[model samples]
Target: MKIQIRLVLILFNSCLCLYGQENPRLDSLLNVLKTQKDDTLKVLTLEELFLEEFYTDPTKAKKYIEEGLELSKKLNFPNGEGFANYYLGAGYYQTIGKNDSARYYINEALDIFKRIKHEEYIIKMTNALGVVEYTSGNYQKAIEYYNIGINYSRKNRHWDNLANRIGNKSLAYIKKGDYNLGVKYSIESLKLFDSLNSKSNTLQLKIHTATAAVRVGYAEMGLKNYEKALEYFERALGIYDGIDDIVHMGHTYSDIGNVNLELGNYDSAIENYMKALDIAKKKKIPIMRGHVLINLGKTYIKKGDYEKALYILKEGLPFNEQFGTKDNLSLNFNQLGNAYLKNNDENQALVYYNKSIALADSINAAEILSDVSLNRAELYYDIRQYRNAYLDQKRYQFLNDSIFNSKKSQQIEELRTIYDTEKKEQQIALQEKEITVLEQQAEISALQKILLGIGLLLSLIGIYAIRQKMKRNMLEKEKVDAELEFKKKELTTHALNLARKNETLENLKSKAQELKDKENMGRGYNQLIRTINFDLQDDNNWENFSRYFEEVHKDFNSNVKTKYPQVTSNELRLLALLKMNLSSKAIANILNISPEGIKKARYRLRKKLDLSTEDSLQDLVLSL
Candidate 1:
């Protein structure tokens, strides 16, 4: 039994670790897949390959999964189809962060697992759903799914499964800010891990237990129990060090630093944060490095070391931007704002404060929003902008109240109580169902009749409401159509007026040029006429006309240019004039050129566009 449990633990953890390791047996598997005639073995090999490569190369994993899915369908193998869907979902979830697609494929796998009564796969699929919910920020829903898995594992005496589920639930509770429950579940998980005896499994369990301890420490920190948080973090760090888990050791150090910072031990906080930063850099973990930098910078600010804070924060800003986690980005910006404010650079401080608020509001990051809003309110007050200060203060109060609400804790406890009561009721009801079956059937029959009447009445009202909505939609559409027609006519009138104005300028330029060429005119008079002609032919006039033309026919130039990349700028202008439905003579007049030149430009444009002689350039430009 111990050996079997150890194998199960290894398999579960191996799923996550496989992507980081290169498999020597992968070549053998590929060889067998290429030579094997059996579709079942091929499908299995494909699933193995996909699982091995998903985190490292999701595109390759996707190709293997697609091939497996096709072969499975051809072979009418439900189990093969199910595994293909499951891994495809895992690839999307882990690599692309597409929770919806992940959920769809995972639910399909769940259906197949349920139909086969495969209890182990069903538990795995349930856990995957919990992960999807956690990724999407549905912490309560994630906890509910984790609880369901935990209950199943408990009933089946799956200790390893129960420990994993409890650990996951602790994380969800911590993320949701229900620290008491987080600590409770983390302790329970540690107790479960204590019973496992296999060497390899024991080490794995220790890592999981350490992770839970870190979470518990974080929960304690959130509750302002710095001493307790420090104790738990130190315990976690010891375990991580024992197992040589440098990644988690670094994280625990950072958490300890946070607790120390909250308790006003700035030096200790900075020391621990620098230790974590060194580990993060050594391990090439950008997100961890970014977070540690922010914490260290905040510690410097607490110690009134504004120069140090600003330098550390500026160094960390790029990492936060690359990490793209809005909460951390917002916090980084808020810290920068604080550093600038302390340094008496009000303009820079205001800029960073607004940037922080924008990022916080985009992600609805309430904790960061509350802190940044309070800082901004203080800045505004300092600047004597009392009206803005009051607005920001009000925002800070609202966000702070939401973040630290006592009701949330009470609500979480009430939910747990309700869940426990419901589970007990279900067990009791299952045991006594035979005795009360007939009585329950009669009650259900009467309730069904009442529900049917209510449903029918709702259907009638829904039909009436839908019909009224359709009538209103039709009227709105008619009004929109009328407005569009009026706008189209107004646009055409504006285009015609522009064309006539350009034609009048061309005629005045022609008369001026003729006067300049005459012998009767004095040199001064000829130079004035020449200047007037030059103004008429200025490129600024063309630029102004092009802007108005774009407003009316936005896609005309772009469509023509895209199709004819070799066409020159002069050709594009000719196309635009033709698109306005102007004749050759009118276009020549506007351009201050002969009609023959306009004809030659059109011919060159048509050739560049590769239009046949039978196709009219004017028609093509007008269509464009």
Candidate 2:
């Protein structure tokens, strides 16, 4: 037993040593290649260097992938072209958080894979594509690709690959809200993984299972699974201790942080998030760094540290936007709005809320939109903007109803598809048995084969029908693509125009603000008198009035300046009163003048400004 324990300790030590050696060698090779002059050698070395760095140092991995892309394009090698694009896509997906662009390049590689007929490349790209789709909320499309990938792997007798594909398929199904099916496939995948006795895969399977359970809202089950996941993660961590598998380690910690967060263990969540952030910063992985920042912001928000939450989230928003994730941007904005509200900055809260709504609208992020609208309605209610609150509440209600109905419809559709598939499989099996019997009978009586000939003709007709259907489907896809491209261009143009208009409006607002500031500099007594006299300037104020008030409120400068080429400063006060929508009594009270005197001043101002009843004196002063 002592010898066995010592051997186990040695094995563990050896694993750590191997993991530690990986980073320094990768760093040294990367530095050497950075200064290399030969293009071919540089390209070749960079590709290998990027793959080696991907797990430990994704930011450096991205640099190498970019360099490889440029070299591959220069060399004009199709194989290298495919590889470079694939690497660049994965690099962006993994490091820059640009999954859409990652999907694009991965699809490009998939097209090349078909031309090259490389099964390994095809399966890998397919699995990657599935991941992209799954992340994008297209769970059905992801499952379709994963199924194909699984079939290919199985046909090639690649058990490890088949298990991985099955695991991915299970994740997609779970995301699609098919928990039973997800569990079924997950179990199958785990069984295969255990049979293979692959330690790496065993750890991965535990993580996947925990994640799926958590996503499906089975939190207790999730936590149970996560215990196993934690055991494996720690095992891996121990093996990789003192080694800089910073990128993978960071992601692992992030995963742990998320699980802990869901379980309401904020302290543990913070611990893991801080660890992830430290590694991400040291590795210079901007995307993962941004992710950790957002997660940290959430923890702060939950802890009621509104100021710190806002600071962290605002800093992280630009990174998320630069990475082209409108969804993440919307989340950040929503959080900011909430933080501002918590800090009692209602105006700022409204602005951020509106921004979040706009981004959510742009991305069709239904959950964000619903939550924002509800929050906005509550804010409006607090401000006594009842009508606006009612409108927002109604909108929120409508969205909630739609989401509920859509989810129900999707569930019904899923059930129907499952039922149809099972029925069709049974029919196909029975039909195959009938065909075998018919063939046996036909072979025994070879003279009467007209039915078999007719069946063959019918099969040909069916094949032709299938071909026609496929052709129609292809045409439909092309049409959809064209329409989508045109709409995308239109939206781009609209957004540009809207941005320009907003800029103009902001400038106008700034000018109005400057005028208000100037008014604040002096004129203290005059401003006070204007406010007081506005209420007394009606018909009742005619009996009591001051002569100086009569002088100041006698004429309207806006009118006089237009009619006589210049107006006195006293007349400007009367004109400003007219612009303020005050009654004659209010004007008299403000200027210590009689109502008749205020009326006289108003008439003089109107006449001086060359105003008419059709256009109010208020509009005239506003234009000036």
Candidate 3:
């Protein structure tokens, strides 16, 4: 009996050692995977790695996602293909602009997630789908997805994840103009975050709460809340410092600045805004920077610095136009008009104000129209246009009354509740049942009146904004043309000087080619010159060329110095041109090289530089 027991113990020990060995093998496999070259192999390795250590490496998570995308298409792995598409769509959709294909792919992923019954993947897909809906301005649909995500996370006991989903849902509510509900969700998320001891998440919740507070007319409370928000953000800033989180940080600063502006702290607002602008520009985030610029312009306007306000607005305008961010542009134009009005530039002020009013209308910003009407009334009052002023004031009062009346607010709330209830019941199949009820006379009458007013305002605003932009663009073009004329004369002079030098170099190069023993060599020279010209013309290509060349010659700095001891960098460039067999003219045209200079350079290359007679100067340099 003792011997049998001993044998059993030995066998158990052996099995335990074998399990340990297996774990290290898995670790080793992942280590080797980091060095893998094949996309399929790397992608597979990433999948395995994620299963082992996904929480530790989000960057590697993204790498796996990208690699899996490339490999799935190659291997025709439908499951892998769908998952990769879903994650990539999620990643890109988290940003500002909306991509329809990403939304489509995510929907496909949702279907796949359902078919697979993969709970973890299903949760991720739903969350991503919600984000896509939010970005596309389908706030109610986004809220639905986020609610689903929150429920799933709660079921799974994923407290941190549940908190994030709740926060996302709050943002959707805020977007839908239900700030009261948004604040509730945000505060709930904050409680969860505090329980989890997640300071970052706590700060995020505070920011969201403060933003909602400000939007909902609790400005003083918002200001106090934002100070707390900024403290947390600053802590987060410290942790994220020296990292590539420029956009998020910029946004944080902008939010802080905006809050400060509302609190009437202009200096603090300006400081925060400038910090945001600096980071935004450094990151090449035009939309974010443009938003900051527009806010800065508004701040300046409030400070009664009309000239400074105009300057900031103008600076933001081009970026807004370039990015097609009409929201920011409209704000800048409104501020610019206000600044101009303060400067007593009545005609320009009116032009800018009209433009702002039109743009606000196009965007269906009822709040913006309210503000514009009030502004126009104030302007008319100041100018002693009493009748016009009174008319404007009445319009403003009517819109305010329509929006703020308890009856309308209650109706909106009721509609929201009905929509939510119907969605929860999946009442789309009972469409006739729902539509028939809505067709009841009282509801129909209320909707008809509301719709008529909204439609008229929207249509008028849309036409006016479109026309304003068109007119502004035409004016800008005329100014651009005049500027271009002046620039052209200067550019022409520079071109002629380079051309003259190139003609001389081309003559010298032609003589040199005749002297060479090589026959097929001339093709190489032409190709090289064409390549250089192409590189110089396109900024994108130039960047690619630099990157490619650096990749090929990792020690390029040392190599260039060692190989071209007698050649200055400029002379080396000239030599590179010569190797291309470009006529001195082409080289001069590209490098601003003179013809007489090219001849002199060639003579020096052969005499001062050691070259075998059998080796052509172009051929020798080409080898480098």
RMSD each, Å: 24.7, 20.9, 31.2
- How close to the true structure is residue 409 of candidate 1, measured as C-alpha lDDT? 49
Clashing pairs in 3: 501-595, 502-585, 504-595, 505-584, 505-595, 506-584, 506-585, 525-580, 525-581
| Model 1: colliding residue pairs | none
Q: Write the per-residue lDDT of candidate 3 for residues 507-616, one digit (tens) a residue.
A: 33443354333555566545444543443354442243234334433454455569768778667656644544556666666564566877877878777577667768
lDDT of 1 by residue, 41-149 (tens): 8898888887665533567779988899999989988899888887777554543557799899989989988988998888888887887777677888988988889
- Ranking according to TM-score, highest score first: 1, 2, 3
Residue 75 local lDDT, model 3? 79
TM-score-wise, the better of 2 and 3 is 2
- Candidate 2, run of 10 with poorest lDDT: 1-10
After superposing candidate 3, which stretches have Cα over 4 Å from the reference? 1-38, 41-70, 78-80, 91-96, 198-246, 380-391, 406-624
Report lDDT (CA) for all predictions: 0.71, 0.61, 0.59
Please, what are the lDDT tens digits per residue for candidate 2 over residues 1-624?
Answer: 001111111111211111233233666886888698856667777877776676455676778877777777787655676777777764446234567898888888888878878878887887777766666677899789888888888888887778767767766665555554555666676577666655554443433333232222222123245565455455444433434344456655766676677667888989998998889778765666666777788888888888988898888887767652566677778778888898999999999899999999997877779889989988886774544664676577568657655654555555555555555655676577567756765775455566665676577568656765785566557545644543443333333332332332333334334545676633543443343234324333222222222333334444446665756666765555554455565555455556788768767877776778787766766555
Backbone steric clashes in candidate 2, count: 17
Model 2, residue 460: what's the lDDT? Answer: 51
Please give each candidate's TM-score: 0.57, 0.56, 0.51
At residue 45, what lDDT does model 2 achieve? 78
Backbone clashes in candidate 1 total: 0
- Model 1 stretches astray by more than 4 angstroms: 1-97, 111-117, 197-201, 404-624
Quick one: best lDDT, which candidate? 1
